[model samples]
Target: MASEILSTTDCETIVKNYLNRNDFEVMWYNLKPFFSEVNGFLGEHLLLLIDVKIKERTTTLRFFTKRFPFEHPMQSQYLNSMQGWQREIYFFETFLPNLERTLPGYSLDFVPRYLLGKPNDIIVFEDLTLRNFDLPRKPSLNLLDNQHICLAIKALAKYHAGSLAYEEYKSRELGKPYRLYSGEEELIKEPLIRKEEGFLGYDWFKAGVSGLRALINRVYKGEKPLEEVNAKFEILVEKALQLMFPHSNFRNVLAHGDLWAKNIMYQYEGDSSEPINVLLVDFQLQRYNVPIHDVLLFISLTTNRETKQKYFTFYLNYYYKEICNQLQSLNVSPEEVSMAYDEFLGSVTFIMPEIKIQGALQRLQQCGNKDFYTKLLGNKEEFIKFVFGDKTPFALELFDTDDNFRGLLTEAVEEVIESCLYPEIFREDCYRILEDTLGKSAYELKQYKTETIDEKEFLFKLEITVVIEKNEKEFKFLVQNKPLGFAKVIKKL
Candidate 1:
């Protein structure tokens, strides 16, 4: 019914514009819904398959059209608030054209060819599926094998390199440094970072943090209380928020902010299962950030633990090398355009904890059974409330029953603890055999009360009380500490 609004003449005009030929007459045309409802949350998609006749010749044309979700006012409002539609339109219209011109022979095979775009209304692209490019046969969690992962990484490398090259060209032409989010162009400004009044506001982020906190509290309840870990998690949240902004000291490039399996398509060799090419779609969340931001997200969301462990270093090396090669091809020095391998590794290690949290939340939503949650709670909002609110019993039950869910959540927690939180204490030689020797020790945070010791001086004392269970029975030891320490706070102006 929605497709009825576009007449045959309209379709003919679109096809004519794309082909740059007015002689072709429309013979047949059909528009159908494209992907699933979950795939395009902020927009509607239509697959347009048309047959055109030119003189005595007949040819088929396939196009994918994405339009604003006008039917869903709330979603439209959200998109407008975040400039999602505008950013995507800029990508297809201005950004791609400039990139192609800057690096004239460089390969943009990873990007789908943009056909036409109407600002905040619709964008049409050559349907990549017609060229044998398709989504991986399985869901994101299980879809990408090592080959797919490598290809995706390589594609990302090229994309980042291309953007950097374009920036260099624009800077030279303008006689000044040119950055995408230079605060001059509203359309290219950063969208989601520190934005507190939209769908992805602080409340949404807090909800995700609350959900993770609940899971941590539930999982490590008895002897292994996570007071220190929880404290670190709060700090990590702040750090993660800061990381969303671009670091001036680091190598910043245009990153596909949402690079997951669903956003990628692979063109396989004829008949064989080997993929020879990759195409990245969806630029709504594109932003200027460190290269590792995209790399960490893609690897974390798409691959399993074993795949990551086995090929993590190889993938990193491959991406770095590819991007360096891409830079070299574009006449830019890799040393100047890209971060060194050791620096890249440091960036990866530093940012991985927050990425783990992001991966956990995204994977949970992707892999979760929405119908089951909605049916259980009467609606999707209620289900979100259940997770974000104090409903740890249900969470614990889900954790116990669902292997995939449990694995994803626990992996995030374990990674944070092992990599980010109290690494010095945990990694020490003295604690090497503590877990094996003590079996498991549980502790509860009885009191974590803070008092202002000197209001004028901005000095505070934190008192922590813990109850630890020693033996198998209820042999609890109440350790009520005095003041843990005096923290001096400097008020920032």
Candidate 2:
């Protein structure tokens, strides 16, 4: 075994944990262990390719295992400090079981069956490769393609729909709404938004930052680029961190939470480039949040520049339709599942900052994307300026040139404007309802959409007033806009 994370004894225990009592006898052999280069910091992913025999049947099994004991010191730090293993256990044992029961047989196959999982021990799963499933020929490039994006979206839709169905079921049958795996755990005391440590508090974010820094040093050898990238990254990272765990006012569903190329596998038919099946893996970061959180993360991290530009809206609508269909299958009403167009758009915009951060880091650490990055990053002269961060200076060219990068920024701005405008729309609808009830003489509501001095301020710059003169006395109401919600209503002469 090349990985020190799991020993021969650990392997034996994993096998024993999965075996049935009905088996007359069982034997395990050829415990060859290898590493998956694609994985990032849920500790080391040790894949054990072994041959197993039960009575007359002999079959080969591929077991995916994660153990901190044998991982590199830094990897161990990320895993232990973040408590990622416990999350995986809860996902496998608690979340999946509940979700599976809610899904019909047609959709249940999207998730790979796990053999066994335990805290502080190895988690084992059936290898999709044995079933002729494969990693994308070019994960970096393919993720940017329409085929892959659609496949991921469809699978995510099913997962989210199933979760929502389960939630509704619990509410009706159990007298309470169902909670997600994250809610089951008591450890998540602090919300990510309030954390002063920015996005660096979580182990995964720390690991990503470390990887990005390493990539910058490797590509451009100067302190200046490192400092520049870090400064820009810190701002984006903070925003990205918040988006990763959005406080969505809309309904929440179980997010895969760590959706990326390696965590999702696509199975194809007869050497076809198109995938017939998509399976989600690695639920260690699973959270209860907006379903769009997963959708945006998948699109941002995997889909290419042109694909994002062309199909981002199409993809969103397609997923919404799928959700509607899935919910109907579960007997949920269409009214309850009415598509939140604004919510999806806002989330897509929210995730724009993370697109570059995640994509750049994934590309840096990816094994097959060497030629891809080498082409996009630069020639010898440009490379020198990028590394040194001084002299002629090499700015990150991808943000300007890449279609996806520009699209993310554009969508982000649009989302911010919409976020500001939608409230006024909501208030208008509310006023109509109130006016119908009150039989008003005259009322006027005006809203201003003004950009602020501080770029991050999300509130609509507005001044609103309402006047009603009745019974020889005039009543006036006035209010100002605030991000947390409309400020307390004021009465004036």
Candidate 3:
């Protein structure tokens, strides 16, 4: 394994040496990025696939080399604070392989195996795609449904259970706690908490809340006024951030910090819609945090509104049961470690609003970086504003059009409203907003492909039939061919 990045020629040389087969000849090889622009922001992903010929037999081999700061901007403070590809290298090299001894029955082999590991802030792994692993269709645009969600949750439970077992094994054998990554205890500290004020002063936290407020105000005008609850918003966001970090009372398991739908892959059992296996890629954001951190983030960010409404409790129970079962499989009692439903719900409720805010921004970001930057206008001071620009299309535009984003936002919004946990003022305010907009109404959204009005705008129409006050309100109106980033009553009667 090279400590530093190798050039094209150097990569070929290392490949030859690593293969260590004189009888084989490398036929053709190429390197490509593993993540698309939407799924990836940091780190340079160089996936190399090579074909080799040995004794008139030709076979192909694949390896993935991920180099941080390869082409991405390493200047942003938020991006810099997230620097830890090497931690993942440590995970794959020293920690993951022990799953066989730790939990012999469970299959924790979903992750890609490493061909080379860290020395110079880079790690290489065997590509799993060659084994027929694939991302969900329209991964960036689609919401993960219940079946796939279950698979992902189970996979995460197994990984967490394995980590817990590994920790026990290390204590028994090494006579001390095992550190999977260097300075892991310190490195895994929550980024939202600053030295003095905690998440209250964190820029990302502030930006997320501010962006949510702006979007709400713009979309749900004259209802759900959040101007006065600014301080309350900050407080709630702080509470949620606190819930994310590990405490002494809870068992700290490894969390896949960025657990969105895009980072996970699945393989089906021969033309069946049900997925038989799941794999989690992208460990750059790995941290030692509560399992709920991964669980909440994944569910909140990935599931659609309908899924959450129908199966939120079911999914939580599912994950909790899986955790208990997996730990018990390793002879650990569930009561001792499993997070109770009440505690889990508390964390989920507190964090849902904040996560929804993030989910919106991330969806808007998926529209395109170029569009976002244009709205940004080189104004770092107004970054949050840029993130919610009207001109810029966001996932919200697809709300009435696409079921996935809509279900996700709807579930998030409804969960927060149902909790009644927000400050009375904020809760009442938002409640009124929902009642005025969607109350007593069953809205079925419809879409039609229309002509472009001009180069700057496209002319599209959304039709909705809402039942309210024992009356049906149906309306079709033209929207200026853009992603409606916020919920606005275009023609509500």
Predicted structure with the largest TM-score when compared to the true one: 1
Can you write out model 1's per-residue Cα lDDT over 1-493, one digit (the tens) per residue? Answer: 5345456776776787788878888888876788654447668888877889989999888899887888766557667777888888888778777788778797678888876666677777888877888877555444478888888999898998898888777878899887776656666555665636434444446666666677876656333347877887777777677777676656677788888877888897665567888899999988777788899889888876545644565677799899888888888876655466656655665555557667765665554455546464455455445533333455555677877777766765555554334322111111112222234323332323334545554343433343446422222111111121112123211
Sort by lDDT, best first: 1, 3, 2
Question: Alpha-carbon error at 250 in model 2, in Å?
Answer: 1.5
**Clash number for each model:** 4, 10, 4
lDDT (C-alpha, whole model) for all candidates: 0.66, 0.53, 0.54
* Clash pairs detected, candidate 3: 304-407, 305-407, 305-408, 397-484
Compute the lDDT for candidate 1. 0.66
User: How high is each candidate's TM-score?
Assistant: 0.77, 0.64, 0.67
List, residue by residue over 1-493, the lDDT tens digit for candidate 2: 4334445555555566555434433344343344423343455455666556667877665776554444344434445555667777776777777666655553466677676665765677776776767666563543546777778788888878887777777777788654553444532322222244423234334544554444344344333345664565466656655654535445667677668777788888867877777888877666666677677667656754345544555677799888778788888854564345544444444444544454444443332334434652445444323322231111224333554433443333232222323332223222432344345425433222222323344333333334344323223333333342322233232
- Distance from true position, residue 349, model 2, in Å? 4.8
Q: Sum up the clashes in candidate 3.
A: 4
| 352-426: candidate 3 lDDT, tens digit per residue | 444544445454343333544454545544443443223123433444455544544444443333222222112
**Which candidate do you rate higher for TM-score, 1 or 2?**
1
- Give the clashing pairs for model 2: 5-70, 143-302, 144-303, 144-304, 220-387, 221-387, 222-387, 222-388, 225-389, 305-404
Model 1 ranges off by over 4 Å: 2-13, 35-38, 56-60, 139-143, 174-176, 193-201, 221-224, 270-272, 370-400, 423-493
